[model samples]
Target chain A: MIIIISFFSFILEYLFNYLLKKTLFLPLITLTTTVIVRPFFKKNNNLFYMFCFILGFLYDLIYTGNFFLSAGIYLIIGIIINLISTNMPNNIFTSIFKIICAVIIYRTLCFLFFYINGITIFSISNLFKSIYSSLLLNIIYGTLIYLILYLLSKKFNIKRID
Target chain B: MHKKEKNKRTIIILSSIILSIIIATIFIKKNFNIPSYGIKDGMMYVNNIITRIFGNKDYYKLEKENEKLKEELEQYKDYKSLNEELNNEILKLKETLSIEELISDREYAFGTVINRNFDYWQEKLIINIGKNKEIENNMAVISNGNLIGITDDVSINSSSVILLSNHKFPLNISVKIKIDDNYIYGILNNYNETTGTYEIIGVVDNIDIPQGSKVYTSGLSSTFPSGILIGNVEDVTTDNFDLSKVINVKSETNFDDISYVTVVKKGNK
Candidate 1:
């Protein structure tokens, strides 16, 4: 189930990256975090981190061309999300809040990495634009994935850590 | 439970070590990213077909635009004979002076642009042709009959082009500005985003170069062929240090609407 979600997100990322204009960024990180760090994969921390690392490694290999950069970023973000989501309430509103927080952390980490590496020029305006432009679609995507998993978890015997 | 805890700790330590080693290697060695050449090319090919089938464009507007371009092309046709005569005269002069001939005669590989990742949209573009098409690094790419960029990285089935408008990368192409049969050479290195102009610096000539003069590749550099049109001078000014002239050039080629490009393959540059 986790692999299916990861693969779906990967395909969507490729399609959206090619088809969509520069303004609309499909949040692959946000979508992956919302599902993999949820109750379905809670007890399997090692597997969760492995999935994040591999997904990020593939992303770097194909898209970014900076090996291990996104892998490390995704691993750290996954760990942070897991630690936080364990304490938060497992409901619709809290899910939305978690998505928002995840996006903020993700963007902040990316900005810091890019800035430190001198990959991008120092521009606060550009950073803010990247963050805001991705918010609307990512929030919707995160929430929808959460709702689907919530329904599936009820039907099956997936342990809910929260 | 004790065994599970130990296993988890082992996994954490191993992961940390592996990640650190890979990161260190990447930092030490440039161009370390593993190339997924086949997979990327296949995905791009699929993307091209999908976009073609579901491309959203106003056809009526495009038809009208095409008609307008056809009329403009007719005007250029009138100057074709005069242009040919001048080119012939230039060739004769070069032969008489024992000068090296420009690479006006070359093979061109046509390719469709397949991807422009938003993160590097301004910096680079991925094209369908690569090593398979004999494309090499530093080859010049043109679209809309104007020099747009140069090929940077070539994979098995695709290539990445570094656009001139990218500020993230340092792009310095030697160019010549024609002023009444005299050419002023300079280095084009800066692109002004707000003004939509290119800045050509390092021109040490102490002469008056009028605005609207045409810019072309000097061919002094090995990367680009001579006589490829760059743009027209929009403004001319002296540098702050008052050592050399800086010319601002405006290009007619629209960077935002590029879909097809041709890579010029020169022989033994």
Candidate 2:
């Protein structure tokens, strides 16, 4: 039931932004509508949840030592992002902003949660730097993912299943 | 469609995807790894020789190295016995050891440096030594304070060296902190270019090692002559930073200046 969750090493900057209450003014994630549903089952209402769930699933798979943290975070983020974007049409830029915001938002929540829980030894400065670095890295990753989706759209003739 | 029907559809899809992902996690965890692609070991050197013949100045430097090695070969063969005695004493003290057993039996073979994979992804220096030269897998490869790496793949006249700078590479090294009397053991992992993170890992465990220290190979792993220069310590972040300390080792041998290299026949040449 995650709304958004993502990983990036430059999370420190984002943390700084949050502590300063500075709005990023830039999103760091890229969203991808499902290719399978967009192509065949044009009315695949559950597609958003599926994609979000899989995103978290992949995050978990990539970093196994963290246990289920990535997967849990991914699922939560997926649900949240998809729900928030429910009314918005799947325009490429809109999806991009939503994904980017999702990453920062999730990371912010994690830092606050960890800080409140007294589990982390991070100062606001370190946490902010971590967020910033993670965000920068996530932007690169998010861009590449978006490019692949663009290629998929062109090659496979897929579109938003609306 | 009815609201109830839509909610059910969403629930079913999310559950199924999440469930499948959970199941797939087992497979992905075990199998979903990045495929390693590179210029396979041996052809690289032969290619270098050809590239040199056509007036590549890089080849000339290697020609110079070959001449130097030829001279060292004669001297190395002469003092194998006295070197063996020093090898024995050191081996006795090292437990959880690698090179000690190697030196005790005096088992080693000679190999020559052929080419270095000086690319960004892999910093490995490929050598023209293999099982034929008694070079086995994981044998430490060093040339002066410059630790090249350990042997990986071996053919008749060739073996792949996993360089110290390789992301996939890990060396069990001991740190010589200027401030502390004790030596700490840590694994040196390569720098992640995208993240700009270098790990001198394992210090986050039991050892209370701090930043600004020096890291060296614990000749205990193999015959690396223990106190050879390793690297300078950087900020000591959490163990979550990586398996190693985020060490920034400014290597004595500038990567570009590495032309001549000597492969230590640790036990006996």
Candidate 3:
């Protein structure tokens, strides 16, 4: 199940990246989908972390060519989500909120990385535009994924591991 | 007690992985030639198949249009060769009277865009042709008879083009505007993100360039061939110190719909 979900997430990510290559807004569909479905396998923490690392590493290798950059970013996100999940109630709203937070944090780190690498010149308006558009698309995609997973779990009688 | 131990172990593992990733990133950054192990090639192959299967049909339509345009271009090439022969005859006549020959040769190769960088602000494109096709760094890429960008990185089967609109690696091209018998010179520098236009600087304050004046490459630099159509002057304003005027140019190439481009190379005839 974990492997299937990870592969599906990768396909979704690749499709989105190809479709929206030139757009300012990038949807973190794979990360969001993984986060939304994570509650289903809450007992398999090690498997989940490994899955995140592999997904991120493959993403960097195939798309960005930045080596382990996305791997590190995905691991950081996985850690944060895991930490938060321990305290937060498992619900659709919480899933959406967590995904939003993750997206924001990841984008901030990316911005800082690009700034340090001198790839993007610092412009306040451009930064704000990037943040807003990225947040908007990610939130929409995250919400949809959460709703779909919630419906699937209810329909299939899947029990939460916790 | 068992849960606490598991959590501690997880933290240790996560930290080690992160540390290793950071070290690997640094190492890869220093070693520039590390092969991608066929990952990039495989991904491109799959992507090409997917695009062919489920992608937009407009690309096919555009390919047909391009074929028609190529035919027209062949007709123009014949006319150009005849005109060049006449000019060479005139130059030969003048050479007998002690004038120097000034004609140079240029070669062009066509390529299709295979990929583009996902960074919105960075205008970089990857084309299908590469080092095997004699493509090299600094070759100018043109689309729709206008300058698009120059080649930056070239691999065995692909090359990355840095576009003119890129802010990080903005290109400087010498440009000119002909007014009656006089030619006005200026340097096109950085792309302004706010205004979405290329900033033209260093024009003499005396030359009053009218709005909608055509701008072309002055060919002062070896990076790009001379007289390639760049864009038209949209607006001109004086700088803060009043020494030179700041001109904004609207680029001729429509970046959104670029499908095919010709890489221009300068060589001996």
Q: Could you say which candidate leads in lDDT?
A: 1
Q: Which lDDT tens digits does candidate 3 get at residues A1-162?
A: 556766776666666655675465576777676677678766777767777777777877666666776777887787788888988887767887888777777677666666665566666566565666677667787777667767777898777743
Instruction: Write model 1 residue lDDT over B1-269, tens digit each, in one string.
Output: 98999787768846864674467346524544335665676676666666786555557877998999999899888889888999789879888998775566457899877777544446678888888889998898999888888997688778889888888544578899999989989999777766879899999999898988999988777677788888999999999999999999998887867878999865433
Better of 2 and 3 by TM-score: 3
Candidate numbers, best DockQ first, in rank order: 1, 3, 2
What TM-score number comes out for model 2? 0.38
Candidate 2 lDDT score at position B99:
48
Q: Per-chain TM-score of chain B, candidate 3?
A: 0.76
* Model 3 CA deviation exceeding 4 Å by range: A21-25, A135-162, B1-34, B59-104, B112-120, B238-241, B254-260
Which ranges in model 2 have alpha carbons more than 4 Å from their true place?
A1-43, A63-67, A109-120, A134-162, B1-85, B88-269
Better of 1 and 2 by TM-score: 1
lDDT of 3 by residue, B148-231 (tens): 889966776677788887775546888887666777888988876556578889998497788878887777777766777778
Candidate 2: lDDT of B158?
63
As a whole number from 0 to 100, the lDDT of residue B254 in candidate 2 is 47
lDDT (C-alpha, whole model) for all candidates: 0.73, 0.49, 0.72
Candidate 3: residue B97 lDDT (0-100): 82
Order of candidate numbers by lDDT, starting with the best: 1, 3, 2
